[model samples]
Target chain A: MRKAIAASAAVIMLSIGAIAGAAEVKMVGTVQKIEMQGGAATVTLKDTKSGNEVKVTVKDDLTLDKFKDKRIVDGDEVRVKYDDGDGVVTIFRKTAGC
Target chain B: MTKILFTGLVAGAVMASAAFAKDHPGREYMEKNGYKGPETCEVCHPGKAKEFLSTVHWTHASKVDNVENTDPAREYGMKNRIYTMCNGNDIVNNLKEIPKTPDAKGTKFSGCNTCHPGNHLSDVGSAGPEAEAAIDCLVCHSREYDHSKRKPFKDDQGRVVLGQDRSVKAALAIAKPTVKNCMTCHEAAGGGVLVKRGFAFTKENDVHAAKGMVCVDCHKAKNHKIPTGFDPNNWAHDGVRVACADCHTETPHKDAEYNRHTARIACQTCHVTRTGGSFAKDFTTWEKLSNGYYEPTTLRKDANETVPVYAWYDKTVANRPDFIGPKGSRSDKASRIYPFKVFQGKGFFDRKTGELLAMDFAPPMSNGDTLAGVASAAKILGIKQYDPVPGWQTVLFGSNHLVTKKNALTCNNCHAPNGVLRFKDLGYSDDEVKRLTSPELYLQKMAEKQREEW
Candidate 1:
């Protein structure tokens, strides 16, 4: 009997916790342009589905061997996840990459 | 056998001498000054040392007009006491050190007690004959004396006994000194200067001052204490230290927080410094640092700190295109949430009307570090997916006074779950802007163009 009561209580607490956590959701904005030599870039399609404007970020990717002029440019939209403005973005496919 | 008798006599002599030292000065001084006696007070009251110290009774005598009456000069020697009675410096040093005492303008220090009597500091330990006691409480409430103590009734056998004990009498028998304590000093007739200013001092009939409150209620203790010294004193006999907060909890903030922020921020945090002006006049200005953020300048006693002063950062807000405003708005003005906020991140107001909506928010800024964190959290909470409104600081901060009968800073402004959290009489709403204004009124008008377009 005690085991059954304990199990029931645990389930109730978990349900309440889950309900409270469902209120807010988080997402990140995409980076558009990367000024390679200057270490900054202007990007479009920022966070929030409602935003039409893009954001800018500095790039420090070591793997990109073509360092000179290969950084991102204006109008280049990329899928990025920002955790407090820091995170990795797997560029699914660089489209309209200038 | 002779040695035994001598030892007993010596012990008795030693104990008596110690007792004499413990209870002599107050009694001797009273007797020399023709005081009735300390026994007169002890007759009407018993076991009141605790309560007496807690009240104005113990301190009242120290404020008597003739400082010599309360603080009779004592001789501690050439280095210490030249000629004195009680330690007046202890009482004088505790009050504010104003440039001049109100009544005694050329004088450096004087308080309300300069008119009243019985504030003798040494009387706390007064002991001795009957006459001295009558002069103490008798000067004010002389009617309480039953006279039964003086003429001891003898039995028919001719043996006498102590008369009606004054020590057992109730505190109410003293009549509470109505005409003397509050009214006498407040009227300026009793010699306190016009501290209240413009208001008819006598018209109020001591309504605010009568209820055990004194001039020190509004005046700073250091500025009002007798000798004009800022030395901290312990008011609580049980060891609780008296401080600015002992009386100033009337406003939304606490004294500890006031002392902490007084240097870094402006003094108008909880007070109405100006005669009649927007809240911004008191809290105007925020400096926008080159790092795409705004910071408040530290206030100085001599001058107002300039706001929106750019440090010419190598990496100023010039690079951030996302900062929304007019196309060519100066980064200095556009970046910071100037006109600083008193509530930090704990209050909210109507985005339009400069009227306060709600205050009494949670987690009082424990310190500057915690304040920064609260500001950051408010920014994140205020952000909407694509909302054009700046962070909460820019949108609502310093815009209105957070008006709530409750704690004056809280999330209730927007989250009033019930509509009760509003100053409807003043036409203010929670989480809504009916009108936005600025300190000079010009910015509010100028900003109107922006608010409308946005």
Candidate 2:
């Protein structure tokens, strides 16, 4: 019973660390296009929240499998999650190829 | 009728005068007709000719005629053909063979014209060394034409045209010998050039042999002049040292230091002795047992025991007892004294009464005449011969000991980029320059990668 309680506490700490490390970036716009090359994926995301458009690149390993095949184009509503690290990564509903 | 006949007579006289003008030898004939005879190009260029001749360019040229004294041909499929140059006074002593007719093909002699044309032999009224040299450049380097031996092809007119041997003709047409002149003959003629194969003329095949390197970079004549020399200490040869390590270093034995001692020993020293420019040797076969194969020979504890056995062998065998093979089934106890395994030292073989040999060495067990001992080692290990690998050697010699019988230079001694061939006379390419630069690094990298898997 004591070990189980300790394990739950460790999980709670890891979740809090992940949330602290992440920052919420809000951009609502139409999807432009998605593309993949050299193990990196680029998603053209237009801001529906800010009326801005930007293309973000993400490591191929970080993206979900369902998003892999989704076709993205201009003027389509979409949601995205991303990290700004060495380069930058933006996860989208669809990529440039889709 | 009388007037017409007079007019014809006048016309005929004018035609006769024109023919006379055309037939007569004039100032042009005097300028180009003949040689001043055998004058050394070195008088002006100093070391250029000697350096150039040492290159694969001059030494490895195909269609080299006027080499009257080569040894009897031994190569397979070339029966009665002349290969090596004959020794001694074959020309003076064998006078009966004099006034000899050439083989089926007309004789082709070596000269400046063999690679460089025009003033190389001289063309009528061709003036200035620059003019002569310029024409030579046009023939060889221009992609608009190819001087390589022609294969059959169709002309723009859709007529079949056979390519002639362009080596001689192209040089002749150019009217001068240029640095690029030698490439037509040097780059792609199989073993004729360097006694080495796998030379491709295009940039994709060999980026360097194509660029700047030419024949004179390595070879030298009676006098050494071309490459002033490179610096291991002083930093010469345009900043590159002209030595074997300049291009290659993978030695079969462990370590460069060990190889330095073993590599200098000629193939014939261990594997054979000179037998009229060839070795009188044999490769013996051994009997197969359940586990391995065995050959008949005495086992010697050391070099002292080997001497007596060799003495007896010299007296009994028709040929000298220089070559050894892994043979088996001895009738005499003395014959069985030195088994083949003893010669290879330890850990080179399996412990058995009889076993087939195999070879596991680089440069492969080819060149039967040169590396017979290495081949014997491979055969004993039951190793089948594989595609031969290319190799380079470094030769450090004692003052008295030179590399080759013809000249003191060894194979790698003069064949690399920084040798005498680097002088202006013999042109080598840039890619060869890069390849010849760091053979040691290449060996190191190969060993490192191999260790990863091992």
True contacts kept of each: 0.00, 0.00
lDDT (10s digit) by residue, model 1, range B230-298? 110111122222322333322323334434543322222222111111112101122322211222221
Runs of candidate 1 exceeding 4 Å displacement: A1-98, B1-44, B49-135, B138-173, B177-244, B247-454
RMSD vs true structure, all candidates: 33.7, 28.9
Q: Which stretches of candidate 2 lie over 4 Å from their true place?
A: A1-98, B1-114, B119-135, B140-182, B188-198, B201-243, B246-451
User: Which prediction has the highest TM-score against the true structure?
Assistant: 1
What is the per-residue lDDT of model 2 for residues A1-98, given as tens digits with 9 covering 90 to 100?
99999999999999888768877464434556667676776767766455566777767442422234221334435445556433255434321100
Report how far residue B209 has shifted in candidate 1, in Å: 4.9
True contacts kept of 2: 0.00
Question: Highest lDDT: which candidate?
Answer: 2
In model 1, what lDDT does residue A27 have?
A: 35
Error of 1 at B62 (Å): 10
